[model samples]
Each structure stands twice: as structure tokens, then as C-alpha cells.
Target chain A: MTPRKTDFPLDQCRCHLETGPIVLVGSQWQTERNLMVMGWHMMLGFTPAHFGCLITAANHSHRLVRESRECTINIPTLELADAVVGVGNSDGDALDKFDAFGLTPASGKIVSAPLVEECYASFECRLVDDSQIDRHELFIWEIVKAHVDTSIDLPRTLHYRGHGRFMVAGDEIDRSADFRVQNL
Target chain B: MTPRKTDFPLDQCRCHLETGPIVLVGSQWQTERNLMVMGWHMMLGFTPAHFGCLITAANHSHRLVRESRECTINIPTLELADAVVGVGNSDGDALDKFDAFGLTPASGKIVSAPLVEECYASFECRLVDDSQIDRHELFIWEIVKAHVDTSIDLPRTLHYRGHGRFMVAGDEIDRSADFRVQNL
Candidate 1:
């Protein structure tokens, strides 16, 4: 059986990071021959599915964002939440995240973004629209490829709320097909 | 102790439904109400931040989309995944899901659609933009109010893939303040 991840204590983040998971979006610079990481990100669509990640104009990944435009959304499960969060603090401008974190980069089919093998779910997204994102450095892209490890029995996800806190998504909580308002 | 949700299954309907959740737009007639469950949802902004979900015209929630133009997005935890999916399955045009699925509705802070208490989180969304949706029904709204059960030790989320399969968001795999990646 695949071992369940347990290092991340995300309840602290959920109560703190009220927004969502702290993710890492990375891409390679054609000029630099390296990849950079990002923290500000969110899902865009499912039909022609995509992702929208907010990057500061100065972040190293921001440069790659312009260079590659395509990036990978690496979902850090329990084992990588800490390291994943660390990427938020580590600047790709100064340091290469892949070299510092020991993460392996895999080739993606739909987009130019490199997939992080250590993370369970990797989404390949390309540009779609960002009419309102100039001030915030926001870029929305369509998800071309999404792959998950079916071997892992339990479902897990990580979200970044604000600061140090990280929210952890636990196993299934199947409510009855018949919903009861009284329980609320 | 809160029970672990083992019965809920992951959905593969990401392409068709979008990667967002539904906000309860009010029903048109007393006989039946419309609710738009979106899939192109995201946790984008963080400071004074909110989430964004998409609703397509083809969706049964279209009536809820048209009449009230306001609704609540009750976050369904593992326990409520089945009901969420079921609501996604049964159309409001043909039936009253609130009654058919035994979903209890509560008044919203901003919208008219009832909020399901069974869900772990709830968000009230108001219609903002309709320009982007082409063949799909798109309603862009700001997440006003959000709620979650205080009892859950660890909060997990549901990721929609498409079809009936929904992946449960899991816990943290690792924690890193300064994350770095290396080209493998």
C-alpha cells in the first residue's frame, strides 16, 4: 500500500489561511535553462479547463511567465506542504527551487511547464485571458493535462490562506445522498 | 469525534461541469427552485479576498441564474460530496432538488438561494460578469460570506474531474517555508 502523507499539520493553516491552499507554479526560462516557483494561484475552468495564478511582476517565475507563458501547477500533498510553503518564501530570482528542494521535473504534453513528480496532481495550463490582472500580475490559463496517482487510496490537498497557516484537505466525507438542513 | 467520509467518490465531470462550485441562485417558482453549481471556481484573492465559481447556461441552475441572480455556495465536505454530485445530476427544471434531495435551504446574507447546512463551507455569490461565457453559462461573482464546521479536525475539499468522480482534497505532504525545485 502507498504510505499516507502525514507531516503537514494544515488545520493550523485552514483556521489561518482562510482562502485556500499554498501552491507552487513553476516554469523554465528559455534564456536561463532553469525553472522558477510561484505561490499565488487558483483554478480557472474545467471545460477547456485552466488555472489562474497571481505572480508579482518581479518574482523570478514572473520572468518565466513571460518567457514560457506555460506553467505547471504542482499540488503538494501532506509530505510536501512544508517544502511547498517554503517555495513561497524562497525567491526563484535568487535561488533555483528545483535544486534546493530536491523535486524532480517531468515533461508535460500540452504546455511548456515542467511537472513536479513529487507532487501528486500536476496541471498543465496555458494563457487564456487576463484583461483585469495588469495591476495584480494575474494570468489565467486553460488546463490541458491533469494527472493523479490512482495508487494513493485517500484524497489529500493543500491550500494557502495568507501567512504561515496551510489548510489541509482530508479524506472523503460522503454525506448522505439525501441532505438534511436540520443538521446545519 | 467527527466521522471520516469513506463513502463519497471522486467525480470525472470536470470538463463538463467546470472546476467550480454552485452558488444557490433563488428558485423562480415556489414549485421548484433553480440552483447553479459551478466548476470553474477558484480561491484567487487573499487579502479581503474571496473565491470565484462559474455557472454555465446549459446548467439547470440557469433559472436560478436568471431569476434571482443571487445564490449561496455551500461548501460540501466529504460527507456531502454525494449530495453535491446528486444535486449536480438532478435538474431543477424537472424537479425541486431542495425537496427531492432533502436539501434544506437557509436565507443568504446577500443572495436568495438557500444554503445547505450539511456542507463544511458556504459562500454567497452575486452575479457580476457574463461577457466571457461563450457556449458555456458563466456567472462571475464575488464570494461574500464563507462558513465551515468548527468541529472538523482537518478540513478536506472535493476536486471535480468530470462525470460522477470527485477527488477528495487530502492533507499536507510536507511543509517548507522557502520552497526550491531542481531539474531532475
Candidate 2:
């Protein structure tokens, strides 16, 4: 077998860790509202709709989300990559991310957290379970409200590739027709 | 405001559901073993890593995972898109998915579950928390061992976009130089 076929142990290079979409998370607590870039998150449920995000204690949004128990998940397209990085670069406690990055924050219907207007889609989320927060720094949230820009069907989004690199969503392929089981 | 600028309600769309990487889940219990394509998963922690995946009760792998308390998460690149769709089309209850799909399953280090050799990376996981299984059909797993194909770096991965369409990962953009805060 060739070297590429051999099973190699992934000791310290956790490059595969960057497998999710790069998102801008919005949080609000009392008078403090902030936006921070997040890439480690996933959908947990379908019927009641659950979302999970990992926020280390050091991030400013972690405290804000804990106090408010609500937040908004904003999905931005490739066009807003720079802004995504900008929001992630600044500490929310240090500056108002909205004013610093020139991002327009719109009020969410269900959550007090602000949603980025330029993003293609937004989900207003409420903290469902924080049992693992103290131990894992993971927050489980339920999406109560959803909004999208229907005019643009599929806007390209950004995916983080560790160490400052990102991959853009591109060229969709549809293989649904080949499946034997119609519904999944 | 332009039509695209208007934030319309995504009542049924739920487009934000596609926020994470598409992974192939490997499950085995007794004589029953299966490979099912899954897109709903997230990273929960960094040290002593925790991973969460939502598997509906209807899927065959759900029962196997519960009985075995172990599974493997295989990350496939875009080169295996057709195989991904093929694995998702059939019912694992009827046949051995490994032979049916012509997939190679190698022994895992810490778990009984077998890893897909064709995948770029594989995680041997053991179920850690099942409290949310009955209520949310969610499984929280801790990765015991990790494997990656070191020969290939940054291979294009497939991201599900719901309704049969999939987005391909493309082009790397580095913004580390732009960030004022050096560490995140």
C-alpha cells in the first residue's frame, strides 16, 4: 500500500477541528451587547431544533450569554468574511463591535441579542441547557426564531481552516436523485 | 430597502440547520454493523475532547450505538461524495453496509467500532452521556483515539445544504495578518 493509504495517528495536529461554518454570535445582557466570531458549533436536534456552541470562559460573549440566557446565531456569506474576522479580532468588552466594524445590528423577535443585518440568515436562540457549561464550556440552545434572505437562495459562506485560513462555500452538487430511500 | 436586504421569516426553511461538517457515522453491535451519513454534529470541548451528534431513533445506527456505546466518526472529503450519498440511500438493517457499499472498516484503538479507511480522518468515540437520548435523541461522545491520512492536507470536504444540494469547500483566505488580537 502507498504511504497515503497507511493509517496515521493524528497526534497534535488538530487541523480537522475546523470542520464547521464560521459564524458571528450575538449576545446581550442588561446594557452589554456583543458580537464574536465562532466556528465550533453544531445542530443537535431537528423537531424542537437545538443548537450547541463552545465558548471558552475567556471570551466576552460567554459572560453575556450566561447572564441573558439568550443569543442570536448570525450566518454570514463569503462577502462578509472581513467583517467576520473583524468581529472576532476585537474583544467585546473592549469595544462595541457593531460600531467598530460598521455592522448594523437588528433586533431579534424572540431574543434580545442583536442580529447582523448583512448576514444571509439568523436564528434567535434561548439557552436550553447549561449543565455542561462548567465542565465543558458548552452551551446547548434551542432556536426559537429564524430569519433568512430568501431573495438570494444560497449565498456562499466561509469555513475556517485554522491558522488564519478559510475556505469559501462553492459549486453545489445535487445527488438526492440517486438515493433509494426518498426521505432521510 | 432592496428586497434582498429585507429579513424575511424562515418559518419552514430552517437553513441554519446546515452549520457543521457532513460526517459518516460508523456503528457496530454484535453481528450488526452499519455506516450512515450524518450532518448534525458539533465539537463540545478541546481537552479530553467531547463531540455531540443527533441521531434520530428511526435510523438503524441509533439502536446499534445505544447497545454498543461506541461509534466512529469518519470525515470524508469531496472525492467521496457519491459514496456518501450511496451509503445514505440503503437501510443498514437489510445488509452489511461494509460489503454492500464496498467500504473498508479497520479496527479502532480504544473502541469496538471500525473506522472507514477511505476517510481523511477518523475519531474512535465512546458514549459518555445519554441523559438527552430519550428526550432529544442526542449522543454525547468523548473521542478516545484519532486518526488522519497525513498524506493529504486540506482536502476539499462536502457540506450538506439540505434538499439534495451540497456545497464544496474551496479556496483558502488568510486573515491572521489583519487581526489586531494575536490569539483567540
Candidate 3:
């Protein structure tokens, strides 16, 4: 099912990403566009909505994103589990992942990379720093735009446990009362 | 209940960490020790068992970790929710987190940091690189030793979603058949 997303706050992107769910990274360079399943990522800052992820030079999408200096971070729910596995197993160099996985690509407002329409949320990111790229294969990004299907409330996002296993995001427990107002 | 953990392979640390659970970072420097609740961490490499996390210098644990160059990454289950919240909300400078939170600290084999005995898994780490610490407040560590409770097939870990809400890890889905053997 395609989610109808609305513009979301860039700073609040951590609410979805910090949970450490497996994400589909979409990238484009000229005529080439590709999707790659990624799990090594983390939130870095709040003001610029900084995010960081490790993308090895071996992946085809790495070249596309590095050259374009742009990429889309999309969160796919449990419903897209099969496609997530398919995208991870196949080589993006030989096939178009969107077409092969039967997923729709929507144009990003701030980046050239296409967003996955079926994803629960998508963030347009521009490479902010390349210093660590060569040494650690890590890309630091500034999230310029975010789109979320707020209607879903809580998404059953997939979290990779490696070895072909995924743990689905489950029930939520709120302890806002226990937190310091400033900390929250 | 305290889990009886056994030595786990260092290279396979990503199996538990890649899923993005909220972890209790334990650190010690001389007589000073602290525990910080962290959600911003990711696995970077396999052979050296490299891991990275963003910890603002303002955090008391950051100072302790930086000074000692060692820390313990502990994965707490849902049962330790109250301690997790209490540890994150309270200041460690004036308070002894281990005593206040009623958690036991065990000596690590490879690091000076004490591991939380209540946690399902604890990884002893030593700072491997300090280049990004000043610029990004990121600490890159090499996990030298790991301990895990293999008795628990799947631990119901917590994933932070900001605003004091946590998403508990749910059911597991295995797609081993679909994955390429090498990828798996």
C-alpha cells in the first residue's frame, strides 16, 4: 500500500530513524537511480537534522550517491519486507530496484533522488561532509526535507538483526511524565 | 533477573547491535564512573568489531569515557525500563548511577568500564579513534570482548523514539531462504 505523506519537520526526523530500523537508501546520478537496503545508520544532530550511515564503496548506490551528493532515506514497514530482502540480495548495477521490486518512485522536493512511495517516511539528504567517507565509508548528511505518513501513528518498521532475521517494531511505552521537561 | 552471560564472538556483535536498541553506556575514569542512556549508535566494521556513537561533551559519561578511553555498551531488556529512564533523566556527576538505579556493575575483561550485570548483553570497548570526537562528538570504539545470554532466544529490547517513548522489539521474521548465501 502506498502511503500519502505530508511534509514533516526535519529536526523531528530522529523519532523515526533513532529506533534503528532498516532503511532503503535511494540514490540517483544522471540517468542512474538505485535503491539499497541499509542498517548501519544513526542520528548525529538536531539543528541541521544531521544523519550518518556507512556505505561501502562496493555498493552501486554508493557511487550514485557520492557523485550526486544526494540521497533519500526511506523507512519501509513490515509490509515491504519481501522487497527489502530482494533489494539487499540483488545487485543494483544490473537491475532497477524500483521496477524489480514493484515499488513506485516519487520525486523529492529538495533532492534529485526519488523517494519510495510505499515507505512510511522519506528524508531528502545532502552530503554535508566527506572527510570520513574514505577512511570509514561513512557519509554525513543534512536532512533538508522530510515526508511522513502521520496517519500510521506507529509504524511496524523492520529492524535488521543480521543472519537474514528481522525484528519488527512493537508496542510503545510512554514515560514522558518521568522525563525532565528540558530533556524531553 | 540477572542474566548469566557467556563469552560471545566479537565479530557477531552486530547481530544484537544493528537492530538499534537503547543501550546503557557505562564508563569509568580513576574513581569516577557513570552510566548514560544512549540511542544514537551504529556498528561500523566487523573484523575489528568497530562501533560508533554520538555523545555530546556535555554528558558526564562522555568525560569519563574520554578520560579513560574505555566504556561498556550494555543492552537492557524491557524489564529494566525504569532504570533506563532514571539513568537518562538523572545527572551522574553527583549521583552514583549503579547505586541509585539498583544495578550491579561487573568488571570487564578488556576495559576499565564496568558492565551492567542486569543487561542481556555487554560489550567492552576501547576508544580506537578520537579524530571525530571534537568535530562531531562521535566516539569510535573497538569492541574487544562481548558477553551474551544465549538462553534468551529473543530479548524484548527497547528502541527510543524521542519524547520519552520507546518501541519494544517485537516478533522475528526470518528471510534466510531469500538471501544470497554470501549476504547471509
Candidate 4:
């Protein structure tokens, strides 16, 4: 295939960077609690449930996460798209994000960070590595506890596609029969 | 909402762990070259283009990456789903994966690893951090070079769901007009 040269536009080129589900990151530090919409988080491992998320130092939740070393990852469906956008648009440092966004924060079983009651699932994580924070702004954590909304039948999650673009999880295709490897 | 009790089956419960787009990782170590399907990778940063991909110690490519400290992340569209599945189904250690999967390995510009010519985009990465390898098997790298197929329009990438289940990226909805934050 003949390839053509493309301009590396920061805003558009970064779209490929977003592949994981967009989530609301809840963080608490001292008397302050905040929720920031994040699309740069991913599951890092299987057995121990390692999770990694990138939060730039400029974000308010980033400081809170660094101070408290704990956070809750809330998975919201398409119904909360507007709220997700609202949470992301505003600065957590400037106001009471929970009150402004009308988000219900419930206490987690393990972590002190509040989980969004509106979300269908929440993962309580504790910081496991911060060595790469200054360089890559990545916070590695282990999911100590998890909760899911059993009432939801099919959860439609949002995937970020740059420049205010989003894609909803679509139809499922089973290809298990095609694979020769049993467990990977 | 009343919640129902559910069992946490490692294999079943972990299905939700997969949220990112699946890519075929191309690696070269010594005289051996291989391709492996991976869904557990994430973009760590933009400038300098830091990336992290979780490769279980068990995967054949894991050793190769550790030795070579370089690899190419090949992004294939939905058209190559069967080949992606085929590459992941067999062991690369025992055979030449390129010929087995009919993948055209073009010489990479920066890394010794060959790029999949059929892929629309490929990133040449050099390992930056292996600190979490023993614990989480996460390899952190910086994308030194990138190539994209500018001619390809509307690239529909596949997202792995669980146990042979996949989700194709659907319609795109733009929400950039609503956001006030300039750069995230």
C-alpha cells in the first residue's frame, strides 16, 4: 500500500492515544474531594489487578492522588456522557466538583476516595508505583476492591476519539472458536 | 438499586479488564522475529511519545522485547481480524510468524523490529523502563518514530472484550465544542 505523509497535529494525532474506556477518577486529599474525567487509564495485569492511569501534574486530582495515594475509578455508561463532559470541562481545583456536577459520592470499602454512585462499576485502587510520575505522569495502582451494578444488563461504555469525539461499545462478535490457543 | 451477589471468577470477572484497542506487537531478538496480539497496552505520554504494554512473562515476545529493548506496535484495521486471531492462536517461538500469518514485514526506520506493511500505522518504540517487569510485566517505552497510512480513510479498530469476543468501533460523535479545557 502506498503511504502518504501526514501532519502531526497534537490534538488530532493524540486520538490514537485514547483506546481505553473513559472513566471518572475520584481523589481525596485532606478536606478536599474531587472527580476528574479521565480517558488515559488501562488495566495493566490480571492476577493482582494492576491498573495504570496518566494524570498530568496540572490536574487538581493529580495532586490529591499524589497526597492520598488512592483513588476510585468509576465507569459510567452513555447516559452520563454529558456529566462526564462537564466534569472534564471544569477545573477540579476551582470548585466543589461533586456539588457542581451533581455527582453522588459513596464511601468505598477499602479506599477513602469516594465512588460515583451514578456509575455502574467502581474500582478502588491504591498507588503502587510513582517512580514514573515526574517523567510520564503515570500512576500505577493495584485494584484492591471492585463493585459492579448488578442491575445493568448490557453496559455501554464510551471510548474517547479526540476532538470531542466518542465511540460507544457496539455489537459483540464471538471469535473463540477461531482461536486454537485455549487460554492466553 | 438492589445489588445481587456475584462470584469473582478470575477468567470471567477479568473480561472487563480489557478496554483498549487490540494491536499486533512485532518484536525481533537475535535471528528470531515474531508477532503477538496484545490489548493490554496504553499511551503514557504525548511528546516523546511514551507507551506502556503489558506482556505477561509467559508470552514468547516478552523475552525478545527484554533482550532487544525495542519493538514495533502495528495498528491493523478490522480487515485483518482473521490474521490477528491467527497470529495470536499459535506459538511464535516455534515458527516464523511472518510467513505463517502472511504478514509483510517491512524494514523499520528506527527499530530493528520489522513493521507489518499491511498495518495502517506503526510505532517504533525503544524500552525506557522495565522496573515493573518482575511484578507486573509492564514494559514502558518511548515511541521514537511513527508511520501512518494517510490514504486509509475511516479506520475501524477492534477492541477485545473477553474470551474471543470483540467490539468494533462504531459511529463517531464529536463533543469538542462543549469542552473549555484547551489541552488535556
> What's the candidate order when arranged by decreasing lDDT?
3, 4, 2, 1
Rank by DockQ, descending?
Answer: 3, 4, 2, 1
DockQ-wise, the better of 1 and 2 is: 2
lDDT of 1 at A115: 77
TM-score of the second chain for every model: 0.69, 0.85, 0.99, 0.86
Which window of ten consecutive residues has the lowest lDDT sum in model 2 chain B? Answer: B1-10
lDDT of 2 at A110: 76
TM accuracy, model 4: 0.85
Error of 3 at A33 (Å): 0.6
lDDT of 4 by residue, B111-172 (tens): 99988888777777899988878866889888777776545434567777656767776665
lDDT of 3 by residue, B90-184 (tens): 99988999999999999999898999999999999999999999999999999999999989878999999999899999999999999999998
Candidate 3: segments with Cα more than 4 A from true spot: none
Q: What is the lDDT of residue B64 in candidate 3?
A: 90
In model 4, the Cα lDDT at residue A100 comes to 89
Candidate 3 residue-wise lDDT, A1-184, digit = tens: 6898999998899999999999999999999999999999999999989999999999998899999999999999999999999999999989999999998999999899999999989999999999999999999999999999999978999999889999999999999999999888
Minimum summed lDDT over a 10-residue window in model 4 chain A is located at A1-10
Per-chain TM-score of chain B, candidate 1?
0.69
lDDT of 2 at A51: 76
Q: Candidate 4: how many backbone clashes?
A: 2
Best by DockQ: 3
Tell me how many residue pairs clash in candidate 1.
86
Taking the tens digit of each residue's C-alpha lDDT, what string does model 4 give over A1-184? Answer: 1111222222221122224678899999899999998877667765466778889988989899999999988877788888898898988878887898778888888899998888877778899988878867889888777776545534577887555767776666678889765642
TM-score of each: 0.68, 0.85, 0.99, 0.85
Candidate 4 clashes between residue pairs 3 or more apart in a chain or in different chains:
A164-B175, A164-B176
